[model samples]
Target: MSADTQMLSEFVFIYTPLPTKEAAEEMAEALVAGRLAVCVNIYPGVTSVYEWKGAVQKEAEVVAFIKTTRKLAPDAIAAARLRHPYEVPAFLVLPIESGNEDYVAWARGQAKA
Candidate 1:
């Protein structure tokens, strides 16, 4: 889909990893309260392996699955970035091509509010 088409689509899932569970929870609460996302699911005990500053690194993290409509993805991303501890946080947004219609509608309604 085109970028605009994707942005106007019904669903988008934002993935971000925080340094700690508490940080993840705080960010999730702030995003939901600000209406940037409908729900933020935190999965702790995540082991992340990546390269940083020309060196391979491994670290423990809490991954946040932020559920929201495409219309609110940008705002959700911005909110996450502001609260993220990493210098360059992982703010990945994936489009949901298909899902339960009612749930999608509910998510959209939640984000819109």
Candidate 2:
């Protein structure tokens, strides 16, 4: 809330998978159109490797980089949850240190924060 604040915001990266790419595309559209996010980069064909229950696991996932303000985080999470096929989607938020003024403005404004 200052002239030098530089429009602080958060970008939430969500990892999910669907039976069809259509579902993924639909999710990306819904979030951006609803203004829950300024932009959503939906990356398909991601192979993820991780540990689960003390065992290693690997799978395909689509990563969605959702850009928005901090205030809209809840709404963004909800939207992703509603559309994601996973019982528990990977929702990780990255705080933006600084960015272009116009882009940051749009992101923060869209977030509804």
Candidate 3:
């Protein structure tokens, strides 16, 4: 079977903003270790501008792109929340509509328990 046939709509990308690179790395390791995610790409130097508590807020943060399957999305999200420091964290689960067949299959295999 093709990668699409094997894992289409089965993968997801969880986007989360962390206070620092250390936190992002820690969460990434936890997710991979728990098998909740296959891989997590961390990007630092993110400038976030948002409104919180009825006021605008701006801060520098790191972004983590967690790769996992739909089956583990909930667990992964919950796990991430536990490690998050913010009062309200953003765990955006975005679907992988399409991707490299091999890469997709590999991620799917590694992410599955």
TM-score of 2: 0.75
Error of 1 at 23 (Å): 0.6
For residues 9-110, what per-residue lDDT tens digits would candidate 1 score against the true structure?
A: 767889999899999999999999998888999999999999999999999998999988777888888888888888988888888777665776677677
Worst 10 residues of 3 by lDDT: 1-10
Could you tell me which residue pairs clash in candidate 1? Answer: none
Off by over 4 Å in 3: 1-7
* Candidates' C-alpha lDDT: 0.85, 0.70, 0.90
Best by lDDT: 3
**What's the lDDT for candidate 3?**
0.90
Clashes of each: 0, 0, 0
Candidate 1 vs candidate 3: the TM-score winner is 3
Model 2, position 25, has a per-residue lDDT of 80
Q: Provide the lDDT at 77 for model 1.
A: 88
lDDT of 2 by residue, 1-113 (tens): 65345444345444445545676788889988888878877777878788877999888766777777666777888987898887666777776566676766565666554
Q: Give, for candidate 1, the lowest lDDT window spanning 10 residues.
A: 2-11
True-structure Cα RMSD, model 1: 3.5
Q: Rank the candidates by TM-score, best first.
A: 3, 1, 2
Candidate 2 stretches with Cα past 4 Å from truth are: 1-4, 9-20, 53-55, 108-113
